[model samples]
Target: MATPEDTPSQSDSTLSGCIRPFLTKSGLTVRCQSRVRSQCPSCAELYRGDWAAIARSGVFDGPVQNFRFYLLTLTAPSFGRVHRVPKAEGAKVSRCGCGARHSVTDANLRGVPLDEASYDYAGLVAWNRDSGLLWDRTRRRLRDYWPSVEFFVVREWQDRGALHLHTLVRIARAEAPRPALLGESARTANAFSKVDGAFVSWGEQGDCQAFRADGDGAKAIWYLSKALNYVLKDAVRASGGGARSWGHLARLSTAARMVRCSPGCVPRDCPSHTHTRYGARGHVVSASRRTKNRTGWSFTGMTRKRQRELRSEWVTAQAARAESAPAEWAVGVLEARAGRAGRELRSRVDVLP
Candidate 1:
């Protein structure tokens, strides 16, 4: 009864279970700040791997209710049909070109073309490339609704490989000039930005909903974080390393052949619990070596403030680094990184309008 959105993309042959598993008996903990670490080589959050960044760099800080937040998702148009979880009971059941039922476990085939000969791979890639521009424009649109606001966006792929956006919009107490206006909000996020009386097209499908900072606040943040982790494999893959997580990776056999196991038996050499079902939705949005962001807006009021705070903290930590230099060296590095990231974000964005 669950749709593709509800069903996670995973196969029993590939389900790595539990929170990052411990493969070895050592039980040792190591640093995971390395951007190249993770199971999917293509994860982008490799560099921005701060969990606290979710709250500190979130739409707003503190004990909730200080600001207004909304959870918005923008989806790309369907290029062609592949397989989909039914929207409801007895929905039209379309078969792939291969003429198969396409069970829920056929996750790898979710966004793939039934007949690769007819799929628009090139168009899909171009849309993915300009995705950042669309997001930048979305930010500009939000400004018209609220005098001052902030947004946190994460880009992921639909089961069918179309890139979509999951955004968290923040408006401070001083920013919301009027009461909640769902009409304006929908026009801003779901519809395109305006230019010279013309509606600039964003894509095909978009959805937006407003949620207060009460119970919905944490839920929004968690959803954003989860989305980021999903597309991370592509980022790390382009960085030239196998995706590393908190668990120790174990290998059972090189072959994909099924291995029978005894009841209540767990193999010590089994690979770490890295499940791809909930993994990346698209391929590489942009390589890790690029200086700017090809995805979300990482620079806003909250982000800039958080960057300054992090610079101070990094400066304090320099005492533990090279003895010849003070915290200033590390501070310089972080500042440069932040600056480059902003430029990279603008690179794709400024190219659009």
Candidate 2:
């Protein structure tokens, strides 16, 4: 005899395919499609891979000789001095600013400030809050100099928990400036905070390297794709420097809480998550958009919306196949057996009456 549990439902079968399924407002079951690795590794990896594909299209889909590409890194201006322990493969320094010869493995003290009381937590919070504006100003400044400039940028968290940017910039070869000049221009660009009127700028440790769309360009794209892993990470949750690091983050959180998010922001009653996430309130990854005068970030026009459409199509096709599978020999056999069992039970009930 077949039990009720053995009965297959179309909705249940389809929903079972997703690791984290949920119901829509109209009662449609669907995958959550979260980008955070902690929430959904499957969707996060897919998101990373899709962006990587779009990034490579910009570099490889067009004429290799007509355009110039550069990988640029911009850092946040220092709010306070902190220990600078080098990584295992990084260049060795004799002594950090704290007058201690720190080893590469001294992870706990690497980004921790020497004087916690004197550290500028408010300034750091303010800088994090205003970093998106700073990048916007920097990009516009670059485009003013070279009209053909297109870019893809990713925001990453430094060991000290400050936000920094990694950008891939593309420009017409005929109009491109020297790599140093471009980097210097971007690094020197400044923005005034709209919320509090404070000046925001990049640190002096900026870098830019030019690479062609052939030969060594493959390595550059690989590097950018690898960096996509950082996009979905939580800055405060990812830090692991022991009690000193925890204390550092706690102070930053407090500062973020007290800081005004916007002109009309009320500190205690504000509903923004910027207060919880250390004053970060912008997208982690971004690219230039297509315009009449420009080709945009992805040369092939790949986008998130397009990816979603393709995914929906795939899901629909799978559902159709599942619906049709009952006509197959194995499923037909199971259905016939269940029907016979059902009739036998009905006959038994009739005899009992």
Candidate 3:
């Protein structure tokens, strides 16, 4: 068996020569010029493959679709926080005082591009399976809080490589509704509270944001592609083993490590740089309003703020209407007005309504 001593130091020339073929093939010769090449080709290959797959797959295609877009980000209740390997430091390492060196147990690794073990695989699977339901419930809540607000559901991956959701909600050019009138029949603020089977916790809650588009398909595709890239494969440790040992050892090692190294360990800077770039670009262009009048607030900005205020007002108005009139009648009246125009426009286009 190869002991830690047998494992080449990261700076070893022999190891570099051994991994030369893989390094060359991966086109990593450029990006890796500054750092000592990783000692383990197997691990390096795993890292290279994951990133390569994302790049090759055109994951950024969606985000590039529209100049203006909206993205709803959701985070799940942590199964528990896990420690991820830092990108700046490369992979983790375990060196004992006795000079006994061990590759950092994969269990200790976390964050993106290192190990997928830090993710809540079970929670992710569950969320993916129940995403449709979760979306429906969330939509219902939003509608109850602001009758005029509209939205649609789409699946998205969180920074931690787990499945979550992106809801494109439409706030139209209509009078503001009360916060009480937004989704189904609950307070707009509490829409998510009623979602059943949702593992809700206050630690990290979900968020919603909108952007104005230049009105192009390319921009929409860009956003979509970027969102899709967040879906990452499960992490596998880098170790040498025969074909026979691959499956069993991979599973056993990761499983054993999960106890000490919490799976689903999103970094403090989770969602990775890919998502961050998209956000930075989106915010730069879309967060502000583009108004007909140069001095007025950007249309997108004004629209978003108005939408919030309207939802609150609409909800309050609806509640008042409900108290004075028949509850069913009041709801019907409000629903009818909300359904009038922007519904179809918001539903069809990727642009924020």
Candidate 4:
């Protein structure tokens, strides 16, 4: 819905390529752009690795996992409502903060304030910037309250353009705090900060829910994993620029990391790929190699269900399908060893129909 008025445009694309489309086993044709070192015949895409890793993390396991699991959502307070689709085509007309009812198709008005004059852009941007600090402090405080607890956090942006966090926190069953107590701790963590000579807080206290992890893993993990799907929304692709990735998860404590893989691809004796642990003022106390962003800006045009399936087999399919024609092999005995393992890897990672 953006008009090409304020920003200058009109240059022909020097990058004269289009996203190549390919057919998948599920009867879906995926559109993906080729990357330089990509092995996937169809080009590597988003979330394939992230979901697998998170699921493999065992936080969602009902009894086997040692830590208690909880789902928490931290949000930016609303300036005003814009427009949204009703439950039915003409279910009900809800008034915006400005008192006028918005039409269903007025979806373009989602993030922008109903009355722009009153919206606080500076406050919103500041909160977005300092959110990493806020989260770090909150994690430390949670640990202080119960020394042995741990957490895994993920973040997503809302259609309203506010950065809301989706966290999978882990604590021992006996140490699990009451919902109200945890909520109070979260709000308490958001006490005032002086920014640009005016005081501002995170504004919203946020939401929390407990994950029972008792039912189908595919069903139970859906709520936690689907939060990542927000990156797939059109609003995110166009406007979310650099914020598409997790900013706070960058320097997350190594002790509190979300384990992404069990029997992970990295071989034993391989260089470690853990995160860099940063101290209070943003100094690195422990070091690990920096990694690239996980979520990307693209229109996969896949449904949420299809997206979920990709989490399991997407990377495996890509690896199996990759053209590794110039195969590395050792002399006689080692070559046999390599071939056996390669076959096993391929078999384990084969795409599910």
For 273-342, candidate 4 gives per-residue lDDT tens digits of: 3211111122111111112531111112223345546543654443333323213211333555589999
Count of backbone clashes, every candidate in sequence: 25, 0, 65, 1
Per-residue lDDT over 92-165 for candidate 2, one digit per residue giving the tens place of the 0 to 100 score: 77788878888866878877888889989899888999999999999899999999999988888887778889
After TM-score superposition, what is the CA distance of residue 267 in candidate 4 from its true location, in Å?
A: 43
lDDT comparing candidate 1 with the true structure: 0.44
RMSD of each: 20.3, 10.0, 26.3, 17.8
Compared with the true structure, model 2 gives a TM-score of 0.84
lDDT of each: 0.44, 0.80, 0.37, 0.45
Error of 3 at 240 (Å): 14
Candidate 2 has which clashing residue pairs, if any? none
Residue 109 lDDT (model 4): 51
User: What lDDT does candidate 2 reach at residue 63?
Assistant: 79
lDDT of 2 at 25: 93
lDDT of 1 at 270: 31
* TM-score, cand. 3 vs. native: 0.32
The most accurate candidate by lDDT is 2
**Model 1, stretches more than 4 Å misplaced?**
1-36, 39-48, 51-66, 85-100, 173-200, 215-221, 236-353
Q: Write candidate 1's Cα lDDT for 76-148 as tens digits.
A: 6555655443434555667766777655445445445555556554344334434455556666666666644
Give per-model TM-scores.
0.48, 0.84, 0.32, 0.51
* lDDT for model 3: 0.37
TM-score of 4: 0.51
